[model samples]
Target: DCKKAVSGKSFYAMEGKPVCPKCVGVDEEEEEEEEA
Candidate 1:
């Protein structure tokens, strides 16, 4: 997992692996807005 700990926020299953919300999509969109 990309996160050190699961904070019980939420997650999505990626090929049977748990991935955090940010890792899935949130962070990338934010980063893109900042770049723009």
Candidate 2:
């Protein structure tokens, strides 16, 4: 999972949750492929 910094803490954006900017691209690609 991609780690995001929030108030100096680490965050992991899951598959369905609202993804952090660093993870958006990767998640989008996988999501679209899975739906197809």
Given candidate 2, what's the lDDT at residue 5? 48
- TM-score of each predicted structure versus truth: 0.48, 0.21
Return the TM-score for candidate 1, rounded to 2 decimals: 0.48
lDDT of 1 by residue, 1-36 (tens): 575345765667777887777676654233435542
Candidate 2 lDDT over 1-36, as tens digits, reads 545644533334567554455455443223435543
Error of 1 at 22 (Å): 0.4
Q: List residue ranges in candidate 2 displaced over 4 A.
A: 1-5, 16-36
Q: What is the model-wide C-alpha lDDT for candidate 1? A: 0.61
In terms of lDDT, the best-performing candidate is: 1
Write down the worst ten-residue block by lDDT for model 2.
Answer: 27-36
